[model samples]
Target chain A: MYIHAVSHYFPSEVVGNEHFTRLNGLSSEWITERTGIRERRKAAPDENTNTMALEAVRRLFDQTAIDPSQIDLIVGATYTPYDTIVTLAHVVQHNLGVPDIPVISVSTACSSLINAVEVVEGYFAMNKATLAVVVVSEHNTAYNNETDTVSGHLWGDGAAALLISKERISDEDMTIHTIITGGAATSGKATTGVMLKPLEQGVLMPHGRDVFINACLYMPKVSLQVLEKHNLTIDDVDYLIPHQANLRISLNVINTLKLPETKLLSNIQKLGNTGCAGCAIALSENRALFKKGQNIVLTVFGGGYSFGAMLVEV
Target chain B: MYIHAVSHYFPSEVVGNEHFTRLNGLSSEWITERTGIRERRKAAPDENTNTMALEAVRRLFDQTAIDPSQIDLIVGATYTPYDTIVTLAHVVQHNLGVPDIPVISVSTACSSLINAVEVVEGYFAMNKATLAVVVVSEHNTAYNNETDTVSGHLWGDGAAALLISKERISDEDMTIHTIITGGAATSGKATTGVMLKPLEQGVLMPHGRDVFINACLYMPKVSLQVLEKHNLTIDDVDYLIPHQANLRISLNVINTLKLPETKLLSNIQKLGNTGCAGCAIALSENRALFKKGQNIVLTVFGGGYSFGAMLVEV
Candidate 1:
């Protein structure tokens, strides 16, 4: 499988650190030094996960000039949907006017986007589908409570779309080398303390430090395992696309992996942590600047202690 | 991929048609005649999607004697989850002590179980994993509002687990001939009138008739298409395992496909529509009675208007 096009959409409204500083009674610099997020986009009242996903895919179609009818599979990765009855992928399918084809929603929180890629690779490998589209739309605001000063300031709304095919459509297409061959580990029964329980108003995540510590450890471990599967070393990787959750976690992984500082491609400073869309969004934003034969490694950790890694060749 | 083991778990409490008849002021005979459901299990307030799924997988482990450590992947299919933060698959992974493997939650509403199978087939096709476990746990009661007379009486809670492997575990194992080769079509913009909108109580389905008609039409269409893909006709199909949403819908599909009435194996009379777990539960219950070298067609339609079919050889 290869990626023909990549595009992302952020909501119109841009929020700065001052927004959280006022509510949390902390200085903007203190928040920025702690999280490394400058400004993040928040969705408008009418905009939602489905609509944002649709916008991102529309951009992909516009950039690649690919017919929507040619897309035989649609995979939507989102922990947050407008509702459970109808999935975000279904709404995007309805909006795109794409006929039939399997539209699947795979949720592993932050790892969801990469996991969806693995799911689509199955269809491509089985010859069940030739052209597939994956969209990662996250409304982290839906799960983040305003009063929860810790997690509230970390979430931003965003969506990223990828057009992948069994056959490369253009010379510029990035071929997937090993589509999600690594393993995923969860924190298991220890999930109670660091939790996101459903509340009347969205959900609640009580422990941020526990998530941060586990993420910093697991992200590097999974990425290395994926590299080992292919008999490749860290030196073979030209770029690292760690999940853009926080600058600190990305830096931690970089230090742990002993990769060059310039090898890390990130947009977390501008986008905040977009949940499942983090790595995909960062990849899309930096794909154009990457060389044709560069090797990129994507590592992600999600809430509920889910973590995974996938190595891709550009 | 071959099916090594399949097991299902339903809640302890059994609610008969009399329970609904008394509440709705309708006769038990009328309820049974309208829908082939006589009794359905309702999960205890304590039993959730994750716990039910865990129980089902535990049964599969005991029945097949397969080591949990040998399992390479876990794909959970569910529309109703305990919460969005941690998926049912993640919880099951924790309970089972399954090692570091990819645990994915794929939701296509009621079509989720079959679609998850399709996703697993891809992994098996790519040799990403050898032994994969699929658990379909639906808490239909979570979204059912008791006051909603039209849709309320239709839902039942249940969970089913399937162990699919690239290699056959035993001579009695059912081999997959054509694993989800057909296209899945959604009803598109026609979904507004019939939807499960998020509400304070849970979710609400405003239109059931539209869903009934669509399921009846698409169920047979996708099934026959899959059969056609394998260059086989309905005559080759020894059993028809359609989603157990309603007996009338299943009957309509069997009649339209011109399949033998005796070939239609269903448990809707005892277990109300189990959502994603419906067909899997039915298949597990009837697999022992099936003969070797027999062919079975599984067709499913889900909310979000998603539907698909897969053909398998016993």
Candidate 2:
């Protein structure tokens, strides 16, 4: 499968480090030093996962000549959902006015975006679908308790859209060389690290240290594993977009992979953790800078502990 | 893909019509007349989606020779999840001691089981996985309002499991010939008919009549569509297991298909609406009686209005 187009949406509301300083009693310098998140985007009260997702897809359609009718499959990835049943996928499908097609909403927590792409790949392999649209929206603010001191300030709302094809539709499209996703619940302290309790406590990261340790261990391991499948190495990677959770984690992954600071592309400094939309949003932001034969690796680790890496080349 | 084995689990607690009559102030006769659900299985207060799923998969493993290590993929289907982030799939993987593999939890509402099967089919097509286990569990009681009067009596909790293979592992295995899924959020009254608000209203069916109308229209349509893909019709199907939402809905579907009442297999009169687990539980319950050369059509219509049909041959 190939990535035909990519687009992203972040809310207009800018939340700076000072906001967390007042709410959680943490100093602005401390927050910046710990997370490297100087500021992040927040969705408005009326904006939600579905709305942001719709906006992202509309942006994709506006920028590209691809018509909505041509999309045979729609996959929505989100861990924070406004409505779990009428899911983000269903709402997007309803608003797009697209006729009956498979609109599946999938989750492996924050690794959901990669899983969503895998779903599209599956549809393509079975001859069930050709042109597929993947919309990833995270409405963390809707579910995150802003007053919680633990991990409240870490979340930011965002959405991204990607148009993919079974075959390369244009020379501009990037060939997706591999997608490798796996569960790590058996790994040390995975189940208790990070959590989202939609109806009860909202989002919480009680074991942030364990999560950080596991993420640093997995992201580089999976990235290298996927590269091995294509007989490639870290040296061949032109860019690396790790999950936008913590900047320190990104640096740790790149260091382990022996990639230079310039090769690591991160938006967590400006966008915080956008969940499934994080890496995709970063990909959209940087896709224009890519040259032919340039390789980009997107790696992720999610709460409840799912990890994946996707290798795409222009 | 071929189905190697099937198993299910329903809590021992039986919730009868009298319980609803007392809670919702609805007469038992009226409830039975409308839904044909005299009594339904209910999970205990402590039992949730993941627990029920674990039981279902354990039963499956006990009855089959497949080891946990042999499973390459675990796909869990649930609209009523115990935890949205850690997910039923992750918890199942955690407890089973299964090492890292793709453990995906997917939702397309009550049609989730068929969609999960399609996901496994996709993996098989891509050669990403060979032996797959799909667990569908719905803890509707955890989110349903017993005093709501409208849909309070319509929910029951149960879970089912299926072991599927990329190749025909045994002569008794049923070959999955066709799997078709589509979104119908574009259809009339879809968004409003039935909804699950995990953080707010729980489960609500404010527009039951509209859902009934659409369910009647889509179930037989998708069933016949899947049959036509394989150059077969209603005559070729030996059994029809429609979504176990309401027995009246099942009758209407069979009536539209012109299949004999005896060919219609329904557990709704006993199990209630087990959400995503409904049809698969019905399939597992009746699979022992299926003769060689027989065909079974499992068709479903779900809230948020996703629909699908799968045709399997013995």
Please, what is the TM-score per model?
0.94, 0.98
* lDDT accuracy of residue A145 in candidate 2: 85
Return the TM-scores of chain A for each candidate in numbered order.
Answer: 0.94, 0.98
Predicted complex 2: CAPRI docking category: medium
Which clashing pairs does model 2 show? Answer: none
lDDT of 1 by residue, B1-314 (tens): 79989999999899888887778876678878888989889999888888899899989998877888898888898888776657777777777776567888888888887889988888888888899999999887876776566767778999999999999889888887665522233463345523554334544556667777888878888888888888999899999999998899899999999987999989899889888899999998887888988999998988777888888888
**lDDT tens string, model 2, A1-314?**
89999999999999998998888898878877888888889999889888899899998888678788888899998888777788888887887778779989998999988899998999999998999989999988888888888788899999999999998888899999999999898887777788886657668899999999999999999999989999999999999999999999999999999999999999998999999999999999998899999999999999888999999999
In model 1, what is the error at residue A185, expressed in angstroms?
Answer: 4.4
The per-residue C-alpha lDDT of model 1 at residue A10 equals: 91
Which 10-residue window of candidate 1 chain A scores lowest in summed lDDT?
A: A181-190
Query: How many clashes (backbone N, Cα, C below 3 Å) per candidate?
Result: 0, 0
lDDT of 1 by residue, A1-314 (tens): 79899999999899888888788876778778888898888999888787899899889898887888788888999887765657778877777777677788888878787788888888888887899889999877766776666667878999999999999899888877664522334463335423444434544556666767777888888888888888899999998898888898899899999998899988888888898898888888887788877889988887765777778788
Q: lDDT tens string, model 2, B1-314?
A: 89999999999999999998787788889999999898888888779888999999999899777788898999998888887788888888888888879989998999999999999999988899999999999988888888898898999999999999998888889899998999999998877788887767659999999889899999999999999999998999999999999989999999999999999998988888998899999989998889999999999999888999999998
DockQ of each: 0.49, 0.76
